[model samples]
Target: MTTPSERAARGREARKRVPRSSHGRWIPSAQRPDPLVVLEREAQDRLPELVPLRYGRMAVSAFAFLRGSAAVMAADLAAQRHTGLTVQLCGDAHLLNFGVYASPERTLLFDVNDFDETLPGPFEWDVKRLAASVAVAAFQNGSTKAKAHRAALVATESYRTTMRSLAKLGELDVWYQRIAADDLLPLVRGDERARVADRIARARRRTSLQAFNKLTETDASGARRIVEDPPLLERIPDIDRVTLGKIFSDYRSSLPEERRLLLDRYRYVDAARKVVGVGSVGTRCFVLLLEGRDDGDPLMLQIKEAGRSVLEPYLPATAYDHQGRRVVCGQRLTQAASDIFLGWMTGPEQRHFYWRQLRDMKGSAEVETMSPDTLRTYARLCGRALARAHARSGDRIAIAGYLGTSDVFDRAVADFSLAYAGQNADDYAALGAAIAAGMVTAAPGA
Candidate 1:
């Protein structure tokens, strides 16, 4: 392994090869693919009936469009020059992707919660995606262009400062660092701290029992089962008890020995196909309700089908053959504390799938209704979290040296984010046009 001093020297040299100001540039490729065409390609493998729903969600707003267009951005980012400083990336690191969830120890921890498009890629790609999301979200919330740009700047600066701080820490120290609820409240004051506290309180109530009570009930046969709601949550056709038993057995075997033993105590009750999130709307996702010792004791798990990451084409090939294992391994690598039940398996037809708690106190910032002050604070927190995640897998000293003790890179990223935010609006408009032309079928705001 290279010494920290040597890494710093290499990072400084990297600055000369790709100056910070160059990061601000966003020249679209002359042959850039149509956004609608890219969306069509992405939907080809998805469920035909649910593809329209994905378009419906993305049609909501430019910010929504940006959220669902990870593949489009990945293609664009691939066209840009990079510093070659790579990390295990959350390919879709939008503001909404950072959330508070329970760690293995049941402690409240805030970190990146989505890993659908995760892969090893240039560190700035993640930072730039995050900054741009802040700008786009602010604009969607009726903030001025200046305020939107400021949010991006705040996010970039926070990431830079956090990376620099991490560079000075020992490897193990940096690896062990985490942003729990207790560690975060002290960083803010008054309303900001109160907001964090409220979010924490709400997250505490969002558990398996809460979900079970709200989504399942005792049927006429005296057996508890999940309720079905058409178009969103419905039972798969022809799937019976024998098939479910096998599925659960395979999933249980995928877990760690201890976790498998723990899961063995529970009996599967019901499963419903559930649609979730903007980007994941068309993917095959299911909610499984399990009963432990009694009807009051319940556990809910999500079994979501995993496809190739958006970054797969641009980044080096992943070592894992199963996409479910790719998502699980990537989540474990980036998060300091991951879900204890997190595991993956391959289903029929070679489809990869991963399982985890359906909702374990998962709470995200309500970006749509955030005040400018709250947005800025949230952006900073996201930056800090992203920096720590990158530092765990990438060379922190090198990245910090490249950024230096200045705001040049920060301002550059802000500028890039603002530019990309505009492009997102244009892309959203194009999607609307496609729907109008009958080229894409959607329910608009569904």
Candidate 2:
């Protein structure tokens, strides 16, 4: 086998053939798939009734449109020339997808929060997606084009710098490194720091018990169950009690033996179809409530349906037979410390599903209301967190060598983000036109 030093040397050499500046080019092909058509096809197998809600959410703004159109971006990225260095990609690594959540130790950790579309692909793909999201989000928040470009630049530069630093560390050291909220607060100043601290406070209160209290209530007979509220939260009809029991039992079997034993203490009480996230709105996601010891003690687990990743068509198929297992494994590999109850199983009719805490001190950046300076700080934090994730499965030394210690790759990626932001705007307009022409329906104010 080649030595580690030799591998990094080869990676540095590869960058010479495909100069970093070459990545700046973005000329769309006439053969590029229509964003609306691609989106419609993606929604084909999803719950038909909730499909309109998905479009409605995407129709809200250009940034919202970009958030839900991961497959469209994946197809476009596949058309671009990429370095063959693959990593565990947060395939939809948009700005809003990065967030703060509690690690197993109950510490506030910042990392990529979504892995529904995760897969192994070119490392640059995640960087590109994240950078473009910063541009798009900045513009949506009424920042100047220059500010948007700056955000992308900050993101790229931070990723490059952090990855290079991590590359110098031993493998075990890199694995143990984590970005906590306290570590991030110092990067901001005054109001931004105050804002992050407040957000952290809010997230700490967003635990399973909070959700249980807010979403469930007791009946006259003294039994507790989740309360339904229209299209967003409703009970699944026609599911027999035995089938429900089997589903919960099968999901428990997917957990670790110790977790299974711990789970046995809780009795399953209720499950509801709970719509969540802009991209995941139409999927079959359930909020399962389990009672532990007494009515006051509760656990809420989200069993989200897992489909083939958005990158599946562009990349090779996953080795895992079940898509849920694919998602669970990818989450474990990419996250610093995933939920203890994280597991996966194939449910009735072979629909794959992954299970995790429904809510556990989880909080996302409020990008919409962020000032330009705050946005810049957030962009860099996300980039650093993303670099850590990539380093987990990717060859960090080789990647760091390929990136080099300069702003060439940063400038190139920022330029590409600006260009792709234009494409995203065009796609957003087309969706709006489709909605206006009666080809699609969107909820008012959505």
Residue lDDT tens for model 2, 359-386:
8999998898988998998999999999
What TM-score do all the candidates reach, one by one?
0.97, 0.98
Model 2's alpha-carbon lDDT is: 0.90
Worst 10 residues of 2 by lDDT: 235-244
What's the lDDT for all of these models? Answer: 0.90, 0.90
Please report the TM-score between candidate 2 and the true structure. Answer: 0.98
Backbone clash count for every predicted candidate, in the order shown: 0, 0
After superposing candidate 1 on the true structure, give the runs of residues whose Cα lies further than 4 Å from its correct spot: 187-193, 237-242
Worst 10 residues of 1 by lDDT: 235-244
